[model samples]
Target: MISTRDLTGLPDVSSLRRLLQSLAMLDAILSPDWQYRYYSFNCHWAFGEEWGSMRNGSGDEFYALFNQHGCFLKGFAHEALMTPCRDNPPKLWPGLFSNVPPEFSECLNEPAFDIASTTFCIWRYHDGREWQLDDLKFPAGSDPDGSGDLLSILDGTPETYYVWAEEYYQEAWNDTSGLTRDAVAAVYRHQPLSNELVSAINSNLRLEDLADDLRDIGYPNQKKPA
Candidate 1:
């Protein structure tokens, strides 16, 4: 598992943005219901920012912010020791956001991202020299800060998401959805969306069904895809 602290293993800001868009678009197609979807992206989130997120619907979630300065990703594994729920004042772990640069200071209090629930965070500047984490020690335990699984999907592997989607959304829908692994990979590659690809994943959905998601995620719409 790639933890947020394992910055070298994570993709750079641009790649990570594309990957997050793919994840959001895939979830939008596979999950017709907006509320139940595991991932989401909003291109028009702010004047100069885009937001990406994952919510398992059982309290675990991760959110990312992208803009001119760079990218910031924060995750909250609700069951971890660092969870805000464990404290009387609903406190965040010490030093979690201490090193955030001025470029991303706004993200620290972004209400839409649920800043208070954070357990772990990683960030990088637009120059992309390195992905940085805080200089704090975490509680002793395996994956205590919840960074392990939360940031692992950003490895930019389509198969990683495919295997996970199969198990995570399995049979929860009409049954034929989410079986098209190649199509999923195509989206991960930032290929233009197409009718065939949409139906392959979920026979019930058409290209038009994903129109809003494409717009929201800022994904390339496929008038024609080779």
Candidate 2:
């Protein structure tokens, strides 16, 4: 695992931002390939976070807590609390999950859905060692997208493993606390007033539809919510 720490506060944050900016300038001048430049820039940020938090020892080191969606918690390591998100794509966070290993393709059972470009693995914790997606996380969520098999997908994978990391990103976007019912209806265009679904939404319930909020956001899907 590529480990790093989270640096919070204005001074550290500003320093990190400036450093990233400088790296970007260097990349533009030195590297011809933008992909390689971006990759190098991400590595620098990841390592800088680690070096900034050197006070605590290794076991209690204040590492950066990155959610499956690439949203990072500042100055604290909280990997245990991250929830798995399979439906949303991982590539949403460009450099964070940009490179996936070729070994991942070996785990596919349904060869069709396991497209070479689209598929990727999120991080997971097992007994003691870190296992690959093919060896660990993919078995559960392997079937077609909406087979009502989400729970099953999680079952076979290491305790809380999911296919992609962006599920956490969707969670952040669906915040409805400040908005009124009318406001939410205008944004969603779906029935926001239905008592049951609204109640579920109010209770912070996570169903397939809410979890996979990206599904119908762009286009109409004929299939019902599973």
Candidate 3:
């Protein structure tokens, strides 16, 4: 287990605030009354493989395996999934993958996986509708279950997340100078699955003035932690 003690000097108020905003976003994206599940996969050393097992999905299917892998590769896979598919209206593209293998494409072609990894929170939006991994769709013949394709990138815990998070923060800070942007973006970049919370915070918050508030709070530059 990574000791909180080791994480002490990293960014305090800004990062914590971002963390709170993230959780709050989770609440918003997923209505409070909605049934939700959380799991982690990838580098077990960092997030712990046990985290993924805690969720309700059956490991017997490809989407289930894909979602688990997606969570572990959240930093990349989720972002990829979020990118809109230009060719298919309403259907989203998974992201920029180099040479997507045939096996993975096969799984996607048949809609074998309905929910993308980040899309698992759909359960929150659909009451009485349980989120199952099998509901997700992959390109035909795609091996959405391929172990080597993604896990290869998430071998180190937090390293991938941190790199993604850091770049995310820098971009948010540069685009809009303020506390809220930094806080919100920090969480969004790491765990975008928490969409509800982000929407709530953003509903009343303005990216333009966040920095000023952070400055008033004695946090220099109204920026979120790097």
Count clashing residue pairs per candidate.
0, 3, 40
Reference-based lDDT, each prediction = 0.84, 0.25, 0.29
Better of 2 and 3 by lDDT: 3
Q: Using TM-score, rank the candidates from best to worst.
A: 1, 3, 2
Tens digit of per-residue lDDT, candidate 2, span 1-226: 1212111111122233223223232222222334433211222233222111111122111212122222121121111111123325422112323333432222223232222222223222212133222222223332321212211211221212211111321243343323233322222332222324433323333233332231212111234321
- Give the number of the best model, judged by TM-score: 1
lDDT of 3 by residue, 65-126 (tens): 23222221111133233323323554443432323334234333333244333322111111
Candidate 1, TM-score vs. the true structure?
Answer: 0.94
The parts of candidate 2 lying over 4 Å away from their true place are 1-11, 39-226
User: On a 0 to 100 scale, what is the lDDT of residue 213 in model 1?
Assistant: 81
Candidate 1 lDDT by residue in tens digits, 1-226:
6885466778889888888899998888888889988889998999999999988888899989998989988899999878888889799888989889888888988887788888988889878788888898878887888888677788888898988888777745436574777988899988888888888777889999777788788988677332
- Superior candidate under TM-score, 1 versus 3: 1
| Segments in model 3 whose C-alpha atoms lie over 4 Å from true places | 1-20, 23-121, 124-137, 141-160, 168-226
Using lDDT, give the best candidate's number.
Answer: 1
Whole-structure CA lDDT of model 2: 0.25
